[model samples]
Target: MPGALTGIRVIDLTQMLAGPYCTMMLADHGAEVIKIEPVEGDPTRRFGPFPEDDTERHFGGYFQGTNRNKLSLTVDLKKPEGRDILIRLARDADVLVENFRAGVMDRLGVGYETLASENPRLVYAAIRGFGDPRTGESPYVDRPAFDVVAQAMGGAMGITGPDAATPMKVGPGIGDIFPATLAAFGILAAHRYAMVTGQGQFLDVAMYDGIVSLCERAVYQYSYTGRPPVPEGNQHPILCPFGMFPALDGRVTIACPRDSFWTELVTVMGRPELASDPRFRTNADRLQNSAQTVEIVESWTRQLTKAQIGQALGVRVPYGEVNTAADIFADPHLKAREMLVEVEHPGSARPVTIASTPIRMTATPGGVVQRAPLAGEHNDRILAGCGFSASNIAQLRESGVIS
Candidate 1:
């Protein structure tokens, strides 16, 4: 069956994590994503974790993970001929995504105005550190930024660590990925609008804005209390017995924010009477004595292994083990859900496994259907489809317009 985005074509002009990640989501859902690379290729092609015996080194895991299911067409936009080629491609594209700084695309002569002129119904999406001036002006518009910068400036790292004084960046690149995910949603919304109105508009997502939205709880907490919220370590600030607790082998998470669930948990712990103890009777009482409540819960949990704890409380209340990659690889739930998939590595004899898309549809499912392409792998096919004849391609190649 055809996927939901089977007929859409995307021109991917992103190099790093954010833009490529957004385009990856589209490609996984069956969009014909054409990744436009410069002569040197995306810098991520050099990022490592290559197979032990593989030596050709065409690409690495970082590039493979996000660039899957897309075609590569190298074009050096510095050349007028190269820029014209992109203009031609964009004329027929449904969406064009890029993550360059504010004025980079305009300097290349293929900015939103240039492309929109060629394709009125194109959804042009830009993911940047701050945002584009076209929508709104920012003081830091010209400043370059990465994930950490966005996290720090956007308030995510402000209340993210063990304490108020020690802020920590998140393990994953949420600063980039969150904005990329929003950009993808925005692109779809704009595309839908174009389909209805026969017009398209430029949309931009700031990494800073994305993280701010993600940390929305802090916003309201500060507003409600007239005081900034501080980090409460692993536990929630307002809930008691709602965080990671020690186990015999590993840690487990248990949340009991309601009287009924607290009663059930205490019963399972062989301490049912404590549920009604004056200090632990209600959620408010427990919050007032959170430390004591946590100690009481840990005293029982520390005696059991993660599996033992699960056996006792898995379906009764909210619970989970702190899963690592090894645990995830061996998890029955992961297999049952088909969350991991194997794909061919270009330079290796053995195939490799990567996480599959979690988007599931009954009639038109989406997934990783193709491996990452080699640099300029689809140059001939793509240019031919763009009406470039054999001689035209050869002449362009001779002029160093493409690789």
Candidate 2:
């Protein structure tokens, strides 16, 4: 079956995590993502978690995980011939995505303005730390940034950790991933506009802006309360009995924000009288005495295993145990949802498993059906499709324009 985006062609000129993740999601949904790489390949190809026996080091887990369901084409943009090839590809591309620093693409003469002139319907998108000055100017536009920088500057780290004194970065790269996810949506929106009007526009997503959006609750809380929200360990800022608690084996989380669910929990804990206690009767009262409420819950939970806690409260309220990777792999729910999927790894006898796309459709489900390609694996085929003769391709290769 054809994918929803089967007819779309994307020129993926991105590296590392942020840009590649966005393009990968598009590719997974059946876009023809042509990943244009530098001569040495993406820097992430050297990043590891490699299989012990695969000594050639063709690629690592980081590269494979993000670059799947795409075709690879190597070109050194410093060369005129290489720049020409990309311009030719852009002439017919539906979208072009890149995550270089502010002025890099313009320096290469393949920026949005240049491409949009050639292909009026191209959705040219750029992902940057502070965004391009063409769309909106910022004093920190030229400053280099990474996931940690975005997290810290955007207020996520401010309310993330055990307390205000200890600001912790999130384990996953939500800093980069969130911006990329937003960029994907922007690209699709721009594509729709281009399809309808035959006009293209420059779209930019700032990493700092993306992180700030994810920390939206803090914005509202500060607005409503005349004070900044502080970190409160595992608990919700206002909702009581809505955080992690200790079990005999491991930690579990329970959330009963409403009085009805709280009453149900008290009944389940064999302490029905406590639900009617004035100190914990209403949510506001419980919030004011949150520590006492947590203590009361822990006094009962500490004696039971995670399994026992689940047996008591699993289906009643929002409840779950703190699960590790192994626990997730062993979970029947994850298996039933098909969250983890196996794909063939290069130079490995056994297939490797990676997380699948969360998006599902009734008519055209999208997912990772192909493995990541080798560097420049589709060079000849792609160039030929772009009208390059065999001799022209060989000459470009000889002159170091492409790998």
Clash totals, every prediction: 0, 0
Q: What TM-score goes with each of the models? A: 0.98, 0.98
For candidate 1, write residues 51-126 as lDDT tens digits: 9977998898999999999999999999999999999999999999999999999999999999999999999999
Candidate 2 residue lDDT tens string, 277-308: 99999889899999999998899899999999
Please give me the total number of clashing residue pairs in predicted model 1: 0
Kindly give the stretch of ten consecutive residues in candidate 1 with the minimal lDDT sum. Answer: 229-238
Clashing residue pairs in candidate 1 (N, C-alpha, C atoms within 3 angstroms): none
Per-residue lDDT for 257 in model 1? 73
> What is the Cα-based lDDT of residue 284 in candidate 2?
90
Candidate 1 CA-lDDT value:
0.93
